[model samples]
Target: MKKFINRIFLLITFTAFAFNINAQIDLDTVKSQKFDTGKMWSFDYPPVEHFKEAYGLETNEEWFEDVRLSALRLPGCTASFVSADGLIMTNHHCARRVLEELSTKEKDLIADGFFAETLEDEIRIPNYYADQLVFIKDVTEEVQAAAETGETADEKAKNKEEKIKELTENLEKETGLRAQVVSLFNGAKFSLYGYKRYDDIRLVFAPEMQIAYFGGDFDNFTYPRYNLDFTLYRAYENGKPVQPEHFFKFTLNGIDPNEPIFTVGNPGSTQRLKTVAQLEYIRDVVYRGYAFVYDTYYNELEKLKTVAPERAEEFEDIRVNIGNAQKVITSIYKGLSDPYLMARKKDFQRKLQEAVWNNPELKEKYGTIWENIEKTQTELRQYGPKIMAYTINRRFTPQYFSIAQKLVDFANELQKPEEERLPDYKGDKLDSTIQSLYPEELDNLIENTKLAVWADFMRMQLGDDDNYIRSLFGNNKGKDAAEYLLKNSIIDDRDKVIELAKEGADAILNSGDPLIVFIKESQEQLKDLREKAEEISNTTEIYDDMLGQVIFKIYGTSIPPDANFTLRISDGKLASFDYNGTKAPLFTTFYGLYDRWYSFNKEYPWSLHEIWTHLPDDFDMSTPLNFISTNDIVGGNSGSAIINKNKEVVGLAFDGNMDSIVGNFIYMPHNNRCVAVDVRAIVHSIDKVYKAKRIADELKAGKIVD
Candidate 1:
């Protein structure tokens, strides 16, 4: 009986092995999808025929121009002109920083929400501006000609930079607009974009943070969200609202199931075009290093919250920002670890290389590009850890260390000849550099904790026995070393720093301050590493440009260029998909918002504001709040206008489902979906919850309502 059982187990094992072999995919035969690069169609080369074929929607240049004119690019996100009177619409989270800046001790605008009953009541945001893309002119031929003039890669890069600067200056002078040379497809295409700038932007209405970030970090980057993440502002010029030639009319009738829609905005960046080796470096080194720092800082901040309860709110904000970064890095890391996705990337690269090598002309020019990039990646892997260790990231490193490093640099620059000094230390810029050496004072407790965290990170990266680490720590641990440095360092004192600076480079270099000595010791090695990294970068950049040119030759505009924070129009449809164990709904309603609030037992993140605790009798609970669509979007797509074929705004693109996070490298159309706040919900909340009928009326009328 025992012999029979053993034979049966062997047979079963052999069967399982056979099944695994049969199921394994042949990655070599994996063909790249047409839309894998995404639908971020450039206005310079809109996918007119593709749109017509896919959705039977015939779009012309006029339609494209109108859409482009309607969109507004914010400092870090996207917005749109919703009314002809320059009434702007964007995500509430996008306005958080401006709100904090505009707030006062007596009024917390971010927490309590804000409404300008009249035009005069609107508050101007300082140093904030919105840019409208007025026109685009292709400068690829001129730029490429200049780049080809130089024999060496570094010389070519310098020439390209000079030519771009010259073109930008000339265009700005001629057009009286903010002209920028936008590089697309690496350097294969260059477009000079002219922008009409609006520096005088004012807040109109904003919802409370409670509703803006409804589910907090839990629901962020997830669908079936019920966030009222919308805000309003007005663009002013010459102290009056500037009437635009084109804007999207707000529509109360929300989108239908499977209805075609377009997301018009700027997408920050994507790495879909990155080679497999480059992706590996980012996965193993760059992003992993960032993740370590963010995770460590986040944990430290969380601990500080308990120890320093009085500064809970301040620490919470820092943690929230760090948490968001951690999520993005973690998502990208997971995507890189996905074997199937990496395999797809490999297959795509293989096919492209095959295309290049199959043609003798292309092969001769680009044959060794991949090999060279791999070599650069190897060098980067070696330098990445050292850079991460020594770099003074203001977020983690204490102000004392940053000041020490800056003072050291300042002293060294002062010692150099006038012409040899860096631009920042020469001419009128010297005062600005001196001013930057002293920043505002930070709480001692927080600074000490942050210093300890940074020290721990350095030790983990470089090991405890590293020369710099051993010298700095001496006989102490990370926390004790941080305390010793803080107690002994005079660099944090402005008067002492100035006095040391006046005494010359020798005084500053040998200041006896622990932080100063630590930085001075590592400065030479850091400088050498940076120089080597820069040389490697220049070489890789030229090779990348060649690779991009070959890709453009093979695929043309069929595959869109990687996003570079420029305006783009992506097409998709309102749809639902399977998630977890069940199908996610196409739309979430205000009823679901209350459900979340109740389910979480009225906790802080899921808790409602006092104003929203009791809804008005006439308020509609079934109003569509947030919805998911098949639209392609990424980070900068936040606050983008989600419009129908008629160019009417039906939703505001705010976030994306977890699956869409991987869209940074590959567009998985089957599951990746754009999360948007329905326009109806925005109008509904403004009219009912906040009772800001004036803004709602303006949105509905496409003008400022009297």
Candidate 2:
């Protein structure tokens, strides 16, 4: 009987493992095969030689400058000057949050799109800006040297920080350009970027969310995408259109078949330089935890949508942000699970190890680096849950919680010396950060709804037995506490909150405001977690910096650095590939889009908006809608201008094929495709569907229109 029981247990375990493998990418291959670094070619490491060899495109400094200057960086996405007179273009999803900010009950921008026939009609989004990259120079040697200026890790880190601050501040003063220093390839290099800021940005055009996002979450990052996914904004200086020195003219004729092209834009971040151990930890722990939390928030936001049906437009950012996070985390989790990706990573690690260990001097300097990283990562994983919990922005919280924390942190920091205060609250950013604490959108209904949801979520995360939660609720579990807090909370009143902002730290902390009190109460509960996370973070940061330098020592500039939301030029071609069983075309058309609509029975997400529902007889359905290419791209590359070597804007890159999701770790060129909205499709919509002919004229400035 005992033998039988043991055998049953063993059988159950085996079955579970099998199921896990089928459900996720097999991790068994993670350490055995050579992986591709996938090109997100940084400007610092210009791939002129590769461009010449692959596409016979010999680019000079002038060409690069034009590429860099034409590009603009949005708050969280990439954009480009599609026309002179400051006409900029980016993805609609990127503009969704800002649109929500400008939206009202009478003018539902999300439901019915908008088109500015003239500059007078353009909507100005408040406090938003677009930055153009004007100059960049390598400062790797200076930064790496700074890291070693002191004996202890703590001292070295401080020295490094001070040096970077000095470098950027001094450069900002000297050049009159906004200076930012980016650490690359872990710590192998640093680059100084100088950007010209454009503060007065006005929205010129945007498609309705239905047509813009199209298939929505179900088809977010997939190919054969029908998403319009475009938004037009114009940069203004002193209430007038600012003419940039360079911008790409639209390619109305669309792509020549199999034409070589380049995607120039800022890619947010990547972990290609991370060690296999780090990847493993992120795969097994970080991604899973993030995905779960994002999923939870996404679900909660969905519920919130149904409750305040009319205010759905106002709360759309929660859906947009949380939805995007879920997809990103889910994609990352799946990529980490991929056996082929892991195998390639493992092979690369083995080679990197062999290369370092073969030379006595190199081995002596870097031999234990990987081991140290692995050990630190193991320690770091111990506090992963706490880190996720403590990050207020990432967690689902009431508006009051985020605003309260910002104010609380700000009031406390105001008392500290300028240099000693937290970096975020010290710079030119402090004023804006404080101003954002009292946004005009914080209404009573939203506040009450958020408080209710937050309370329930807290109960779920912290549990009914938690001291602080119980103290706030007494015998009440869910709805009762939310009601009590909602009725009496002083945080909802913007004037009162601002008044509290003026109060000293002790006064604010001691206040009876439930939200403030809740924050105060969380201090002790989170102290141990914060300390552990900080310690783990500090050690890992130092070691990672050291590791970067060591990798630099070995590889030099042979490999590109990890992406740091800096402008990069990725080269590829108008391409097509096999997916599932069939070949995805290089470009898709309105014909296919109409077919999809019909195939879906003309329902919600797949339903055509009024403009498309009754198509014009003259409108050509064969116009290229979406296309796929082999260019390397990621989340931050959204709204990047895809252009041919002639510098004509052919398309706007908006998404990547499903295989490209693993691109954060590996490049599957054969299968991965960057999805973009063809210029013809964009113009077609503006000219025919939306009847925004004036905006189309801007796009057709130099080129002849049909």
Candidate 3:
């Protein structure tokens, strides 16, 4: 027995030699999370060497551009062309809001699936569009050169801003495309992106909301998911279906464990490159406070929802947003609090500082960047809460309050020259701003309930003793105050609000609307707070921009830049990992989904669509459903195309596992994963179950499945 025990000890000691990071406990530090820079590779400079070395794929510029053009950028998600006739595929959740808006009380399209049998049956989404990146140029030298002409920091900043604006305008005019100057690596590099936009986006097909959000909030951010979260839409040009030159061909049985895959999409944002100090400030102060603000609203909404359970369905949109926000902030907070992650961040900072500060020339120019940022962050702690609560933009997000704020700001901006006005009040954007100044059609009862909830929360944030607060609330600090504003403000009266908004500052100041009066009285203090906040913000930007230069000087393209809601190609593999003393499967099948419905006793989220239960004999229960990949993703990557090296669509990214929630800062591929709907799953359901023959036929015509 003693000999056997000794042998077991020796075997355990040598386990790392056998399993390495795959070992049960992974004795290696978090640094063992190789490829942690978050493969959010940008178009400007991809890690071509790493790709070649890791995947044995020798890719050229043509290949890069072709892959880049294949994906389309949505307002809050990403999608891709799947057919030559511009059939686009994305996450079903991405189209949830649009579906909700289209639903009639009689025919709830969101509850029941929407499958347009004919092309003419497709529904158009107004004011919605998708952009394809058709043009890109490196304008870093010109932008930085302009900044160098300034005698002072402020002047340098202004010079840079003006130059960027000029460059964007000239590019737009030259190419007749929408041009945007994107800052990469903080401001170390700048690239001009020109997109070809299609305004006429239409709904193609959607699964029932129940299947799309199976397990709902409980399963969100967790792995072992069985959700079929795919949607199809189409783009049109000149009232005709667009024929896209580049698109991903659907591939069946497209994945294998540890096989290389790539996710092409816009990843929204990531703070992976932030300094330890900056992250600490966010973790300790910023995120916690922001989380509270969002949760307060959620709690209040939940309470109101409880009061009128019949209207519970009305709050889903905001509730989903609030839940997501809360989860994100809290997860980031938790990740930062992790001693191991913090230690890794600290070590990384120490090593980078050592390299940066040791080079005499680099040190002299950029040594103080981090210190300046730290100081500014401290100052920010003072004014951030105040500005967040009281600023015109931050204070009012709901349409009614937002309209009142916009009207007041509009009147104020009208007093200035076009160049001097707030930028949003300056160009084509001004017209849209003006048009949105009037409230959208709203139900009085629904508006009152939500508005009262918001009003009560604001009062709590800004105590009654506050001059503006007292003026707005008087002594009534609850629903009464909210009701009073609703009654007194002509802002709710669309025609009246429009007339006053057009009459300019004179009309606004003399108007007797209590909401308007409250805003006017608050403007002076708000202005002072804003100026202080902007000063710190501007300074911080300059320093961070300099820091970017320093980091580039040190790391170059070896590390990817931060995500900024732009197209980035992330490379990884379809893989599984050991978890909870067991193994996680690479893919979940339709069998598991059915099992879930039965096990949960057909409850709401777990309830299968009635059609699903009576599936045809041709339906394949063993078909792949959801799967996990090591791909790096963030919020806006919702509908990114997961493709193989041959550019064949394999899966559609929708969510990430809970461990990936920390991917906002660190990517632990050892466990963290991007969850996707298998391409076969999407096609299987449409063909065998929903009988979406038109879509299935189109897909089959274009498929390159093995």
* Best candidate, TM-score: 1
Sort order, TM-score high to low: 1, 3, 2
lDDT of 2 by residue, 397-463 (tens): 5677777676667767787888897776767877565667787776656555555555655555555
RMSD of each: 5.6, 8.2, 7.7
Cα RMSD of predicted structure 2: 8.2
Q: Per-residue CA lDDT of candidate 1, range 364-444, in tens?
A: 998887998999999887787788888888677777777888888888898899999999988998777777788756577
Answer with 1 or 3, whichever has the higher TM-score: 1
Question: What is each predicted model's overall lDDT from 0 to 1?
Answer: 0.87, 0.79, 0.81
- How well is each residue in 1-706 modelled by candidate 3, as lDDT tens digits? 9999999999898875667644444323444234555789998897689889988988888888888888999989999999888899998888988888889888687789799888899999988999999998999999989877767667878899999999999988888888999999988999999999989999989999889999887678877999989889999998888998898888885687756899999999888878877888777566755665566666666776778788776665566666777778778888888777776776666677888789999889988888888998888777665555555433324467667777878988988888898877877787677777875676665566556655655565566676656656566755787767766678678888877876777898788777787666666667887788787877777888888898789989888889999999999887787777688899899899988899999986688778888989989899989999899999999999999988889999999987888888887888889999998989889998899887887886773222
Backbone-clash count (model 2): 7
Off by over 4 Å in 2: 1-35, 104-106, 296-321, 389-522, 703-706
Candidate 1, lDDT over the whole model = 0.87
Which predicted model would earn the best lDDT? 1
